[model samples]
Target chain A: MSDVLAIAEHRRGELRDVSLEMVTAGRDLADQTGGDLHLAVISGDVDDYATQVNREGVDAIHTVEYGEEFNHDVYTQAIEQLYADLDPQYLLAPNSVNGMDYAPAVAEGLSLPLVTDAVDLEEDGGLTVTREQYGGKVETTIDVEEDHAAVTIRPAEWAQAEGDGDADIEAFDADIDESEIQSTVTGFEEVAGGDVDISEADFLISIGRGIDEEENITLIEALVEATDATLSSSRPIVDNGWLPANRQVGQSGKVVTPDVYIAIGISGAVQHVAGMKGADTIVAINTDPNAPIWDLADYGIEDDLFEVVPALIEEFGGDVPDV
Target chain B: MKILVTVKEVAEVEDEFEISGGDIAEQYLEYDLNEWDDYAVEEAVQISEAEDDVEVVTATIGPERAEETIRMALAKGADRAVRVWDDDIESAGKLDVETKAELLAGVVEEEDPDLVLTGVQAGDESNGATGVTLAEKIGFEWAAVVNQLDLDIEGGVANVHRELEGGVEELTEVESPAVLTIQSGINEPRYASLRGIRQAQSKPLDVKSLDDVGLSADDLESSLAQTDMYEPESEGDATVWSGDAEETAGQLAEFLRDKGVVEG
Candidate 1:
């Protein structure tokens, strides 16, 4: 039987949500291929993470104790060793920053075919993986000929694997060469003092490049004050030094699931949509009626945001915040 | 210091795409340099400019038309360009990630630069594996999705800040002879100046065949094939409000209140 191995990720001693999602994806692929699903967790205290990842569909949990935090070199080496020992037909990881960082190195070391950011997967004679291209505008199904493959599943694509399983926890030691690790994590620096987390906010008023000048940001702030909404922006606003990086909402920024998401002057690019698409209600204000954001928005106001925003502020309360 | 940058030309499909056979129709498609790669090229040029005796070279695997993309890199500040393509490589059709990585690895072997930089992923495929795979194939330390970078030529290390989910940034120090896949917003990519463009036309651009890289059709065989392509399903219809600013705002406020997004 073809066995599948899933790499579980943890941060700050807590299992990330994507880890369970990977288990779900692994279970489905294993069931399709008539194989067992094994999971690998590499961390300093493997026992802490093992129970969290021990789900019903999992057959075994393999632990590699390296360090508490994620070490790229250790992960690459551990996965390479684990793959050789497990000899799984498919190796799955999350299509996250951590997963994408080390999965390719493992794939290359093993000479295995790699398909990343797979949104969907099906196994017929071989594997057919679905991925989005051109910024999620089009979807393409890729067929892999290799029997053994390394794949990274996109986050939030699959439901988290639930139920309980009595999967046996095992420890595996990898031969990691200390000298080979040329990079070391210095520390994590919070981009904007970590003061504002837009992802947790209930209401958000987001700006984009269409805001034009930096001085105009005051108008959005006035609306935010009136609506009692948090202030966030697209990548351009952050990149332009108009706002702090932490206030950005997009793929590289924050994945926000607010109750009300008001997008101002933002042309919904796929990268930006991937972050805030989970919002309950979306309102878009832009001059361009054909903006992609309008498609995802529940309500669209086609007009100059400069003019429309002031009116919105007046409608909300007209209490402009000090510039 | 020597920097090698990888660039790709992607099809810019602005309108509704028609599918012929299993691929999108190319009649209405316009090709341009991948948007993300522009930031990569700009980062490489900026890094080279900060150091003395730094050489920035660009390489791409595409048809003759791809030279325009390579020229764009040179116009922005790269020293030279190399285009890797041949009849056999082209005839094989869409090569998978491994084949593309191998092809790029071949060029890296030839140049043997101190640093390799590429866009995080191509806009067309968006696989995001080529740079990391190339690093592994050529045995270089690497980092991916880097938004900030500082190179120490003497110490042979690069200090970088990588973007992560939830607005967290990871700081790492990687040794030189490394590969870095650049993320967008790393820098403001400069436009090609008229004089720079004219000079880029005269810059040294060399085209190499697969044979030159010691690769054959078999070596370039794809492990993954595109079986189908289609448009994503639309979610739902949006209510468009057409009116003056005050009227539209009032309507929007009313709708939000109805949806319980704002106070009544």
Candidate 2:
């Protein structure tokens, strides 16, 4: 049996949901390799989090404490020291801003294959990972050709495990220097009203450049309001000053896996498509029938979104319950 | 403030890529500088030409042919060039993006650039993880999809505008020795002039290898998961119901429900 290390993600003592997703991914991989799943919580005063993350499937917990919070250098050095101490066949990290900093550094330092933005995991004798590319227009399966691999699971793609089971917790120490931690995180200013992590959203209505005029966005919002769904979009729409980048879904944007994804007037470019194809059900409303979005969409409408969206708003607004 | 721009020679996006046997077929494809990296080159050259104390260095990884990508950079206006040789490493997509990022890190660490500019994402593979990854390796602040950058080097800080969905955030302060992954529309990439191209070959083009950088060969290899790369399935021909915008809209709605992208 091999061993797997699941890196815990946090901001200001609160654990991000993606950290749970990484643990879930770690468990899946551990099952595949017939190894023990070890969750590594790398934050200062991580004892509380260590006990909290201790679950049945987890074989052990490594709580590495250093600074009061995350500084990329400290975390990177911590992970580097951790891997050096307890080698794992696979290291699972949450694909977050934090992971973005340390994952590659760990891979580079260790000279290991580093796969970022993985969406799904299948446990075989060796794990096979699925990642969307060219902005979700294409899905590619990655098999770790090496004996050990490092992967950053895209947040919100995997389901977070929810249960009440206390497993053994181990407080592991990595002798890391404050000086070794090269970069200083001067501050952590949370995105106001941005606390809603899109990756965990089960329902989403994403717009694209095809939506064109921002005036029509209200009609789509009406449709969203009718469903009580979150409104997001592609990069172009964000680029046009139509939406916030936080709300963008695509390559170069946030990847989402909602239960229901509604695309209005989006052509489904590969870059834009990579972000949301993981949704359980996708519906696209656009005037262009040939829009690439229809390629994977379960339902596609070819019409002027101006009229169709308004009709959807009108029909669903009155009859649909606020979800 | 000198700018070090890193670019790579990649298959053009518009060209059809062959995904045979689960690996990208590199042969018979027209090779060009990566679309985003070219943008990095363009922005650097433009900034260097406009501002004093700004010299742009075009750096790349690959074989002799990679010089072409750097030559293009010089044509665009980089004052010098460096090619991380070892064609052996480039051929294998086996070189993890982080390994390449490390190489870039090595270059930047040596140069100690005031600003390290790169494309937010590349067209091919488009992993786009390198900038942030490299920034961390070298201990620099990184901002992705950065649309605007105003730097005060001696002040050791930069004001960068990052594009967000529907809105833009003006970040007033990020330290120097930072990495900015520029978006495509931020600046127009320039075409190299004939004179610039000729002079580029005469300019200094240094080549370094993994051995030269003090990294073991294993450092070039990846320990993390390897991608069994494959082209995405081609979307089947779309069903078209053409008519006026009104009629078409109705048909479209009907089709969407049938497809399950919308409520019936």
Name the top TM-score candidate. 1
* Candidate 2 lDDT by residue in tens digits, A224-308: 7765678888766766667655787875567788877878778787557668878977777776544568787776566667766
TM-score of each: 0.91, 0.71
lDDT of 2 at B157: 74
What is the lDDT, from 0 to 100, of the residue A315 in candidate 2? 51
Q: What is the interface RMSD of each candidate, in Å?
A: 3.2, 7.2
Best-fitting candidate, scored by DockQ: 1
Question: lDDT by residue for model 1 over B1-264, one digit each (tens)?
Answer: 788999999887754567778777888578898877999999988887887888989989999988877888899989999899999988988877778888998899899899999998887878898899899999999998899999878898999998887677899999988999998888889999998998999999999999888798889776788888987776648887888999999998897778676784
Estimate the Cα RMSD of every predicted model relative to the unseen true structure. 3.1, 7.2
lDDT of 2 by residue, B103-174 (tens): 887788778787888887666566767887787678676666666667766777766666433132334356
Write candidate 1's Cα lDDT for A1-323 as tens digits. 39999999987667899999999999999999999999999985798788988988999999998767887889998898888898999999899988889988888898888999999999876999998876666789988888989999998889998998899999887888898888898888766546888889998999998999899898898888887789999988987788888898887788899988989999887779878999998988887654678779998887888788888888988665443
